[model samples]
Target: MSDTITLLYAQSVIWLVVFGLCAVIALMFRRVRAFYRRIAPLGALAPTAATIAHLPTTFLRSFSGSEVTAGGSREDGRPQLLVFVSGSCPVSRKMVPIVDDFARRERLSLLYCGDESDEAQKRTIATLGLSESGFVNDAAIGRLLGVDRVPFAVLLDPTGTVQARGLVNNLEHLESLLGVQETGYRSLQGFMTANPRALTG
Candidate 1:
């Protein structure tokens, strides 16, 4: 009986040690993941609104002279994509093309919020060859939207209901926000192919 008790105690100690090692490994992996995400510009993961829960609001005192054209006469239609960004944010700069493509293909309304100078704004517009049809800027809009950071995007339906909102750092997150299920935004071709039929009245 004494020998049996000793064996059981040794087994328990071994399991405790194993569990401790696993916990430490998990912690190490989490830190490594965070490090990689920061440097890699995770254009693949979909971040939730909760991630920006601590983000600050815009501090601009005045609005730009540039006007943002509100699109669609329809009382009910596709969601509005509001992107808050600045010329300095690397993530926002990278997502410019993604937003442009979404606007063109989906024929959705898009609004960009920031306190950009007139010359810089004009250059950005020209560089992107953006359609004046749907683009707009209002720094105050960020305050109303509770935005304080760059590279932020929000999705709102025609009824002004927020559908999905988050940081536009990755294609996956954008895809999910746009209501792309399954493989989400990663499967852009499949989405475009199936979207028309899904929306047909």
Candidate 2:
């Protein structure tokens, strides 16, 4: 009986040591992955958004089905921010106020994009109080921009150049578009490539 108890105790200690080692390894691995993600190019981690360098030259339609000439210098000479959303998406609905606030704060001309039906789009426009000048309910724009997901955003300079474009689910993501613009790089990957010091910083 004494020998059996000692063996059981030893086995338990061995298992505990193994579990502890695994926990330490998991923690270290997570830290390393996080560090890598910070240093890696923006799109390299998990594709949060497409790397569209410039706004494709194309004509866009408003939610009211009116022709709107896009891809040229803005009349107001301010940057434009296009947010892709779906009227049916709960997250999109949640983002309406946040996006509005961000656009107003950033001095950006905010535009909303979606691929929902016209009736649904109309309802969404009315429900959200979106300006006709700032609403687009077309799939063509999403195709042109290579947007594979909803809740994506593209920031354009006054000259119609893409300053930054990415998937924005929260304020941090929305704000990163501005941060990317400040770096003077059209994309975060380009910024990291040119500014290697950012890794350590």
Candidate 3:
């Protein structure tokens, strides 16, 4: 009868809506998987294989006009996190705030260094809204740590000993660098290799 037809039509409409929602979810999942796969390769390039060595003592000046001694013990009594960046690098520019946030969260004295020209450096400082402190424009700082790449990071203990150094392209890479302090491994890959339990645990 007419009543039965009405009920069947309503059911058909409900099933169509459910199918549409499912299809949308599946499409979104595929996009997420594709994005993850693209970034996975970039993450694999981090935590360089070269042995990290102690940095030589060097004197530098901060953007805030403070005399800073880098790569050596300081009276501050805190670990140092050195981030080697370039004014011209898009990745470095995009990471300024992120690096600052990470450093603050980790309670590490952070220093930003680059070899770009004075103009470019100033532009980065202004564009990134970096407070006129904790930024070093000296090229020597990077050279002292044998940092031949931009967007590199080095974590040094309070005594100025290098704990970890790596090329960081994402937050995950930065987290793994800090993990070195606990696992005594240069990279998470090394840690997983030495401790298979890392995979499950």
Q: Evaluated with TM-score, which candidate comes out highest?
A: 3
In candidate 2, which residue ranges exceed 4 Å CA deviation?
1-52, 126-129, 189-201
lDDT of 3 by residue, 1-201 (tens): 999999999999999999999999999999988767654222213334543367656778888899877667767778888888876788887777788889889888888887778788898777666765778888766766667787898888777888777788778777767768786865556655787664333
- Clashing residue pairs found in predicted model 2: none
What would the per-residue lDDT of candidate 1 be over residues 120-157, giving only the tens digit for each residue? 76665565554444345565555555566767777655
What is the Cα-based TM-score of model 1?
Answer: 0.49
In every candidate, how many clashes are there? 5, 0, 0
Instruction: Give the per-residue lDDT of model 2 (tens digit) for 125-145.
Output: 776667777787778767666
* Each candidate: RMSD: 14.2, 7.0, 5.4
Give the TM-score ranking, best first: 3, 2, 1
Q: Model 2 — TM-score against the truth?
A: 0.66
